[model samples]
Target: MKKKLKFNRDWCKGCGICVEFCPKNVLELDDELKIYAPRSGDCIFCKMCELRCPDIAIQIIETQEESDEEK
Candidate 1:
């Protein structure tokens, strides 16, 4: 499975809760102080950031990269 982190920029308040709680350091704050994922490749899909975000701005998207028949 492949995982992607989605952030709702309008909902995010730049609280940095997600960035501070990420165990893998997968999130960061840009110059605008909005949250962004810089080391997304390092994400472990732990969902810590998503849970900690007060604004519910972060979400984890899971996708199948390969066909079931190919598995």
Candidate 2:
């Protein structure tokens, strides 16, 4: 049940809002001001970044295989 967060550098404005809002400190701003996912494992699946991103550049995807029994 690992979730991954992807960042679109082209849309990022380097506002650092995502970095500031991330409770797990999973995101950081590089010299270019683009937000990068430094520690993705630390992400708590809290859509804080995704919801707060003004540029709408952040996307969180949950990757889990559904059990056939459940299906």
| Top TM-score hit | 1
- Per-candidate TM equals 0.83, 0.81
Give the least accurate 10-residue stretch of model 2, judged by summed lDDT.
62-71
* Candidate 1: RMSD to truth: 5.7
Compose the digit string of candidate 2's lDDT tens values, residues 1-71. Answer: 64668778899999999999889998899889898876766778799999999999998865574421110
RMSD of 2: 6.6
Clash pairs for candidate 1: none
Per-residue lDDT value at 61 in model 1: 78
lDDT of 1 by residue, 1-71 (tens): 86778788889899998888888987888888888887877888799998989999888876675421211
Report the error of model 2 at residue 5, Å.
Answer: 0.2
lDDT of 2: 0.80
Per-candidate RMSD vs. true structure? 5.7, 6.6
CA lDDT of each prediction against the hidden true structure: 0.80, 0.80
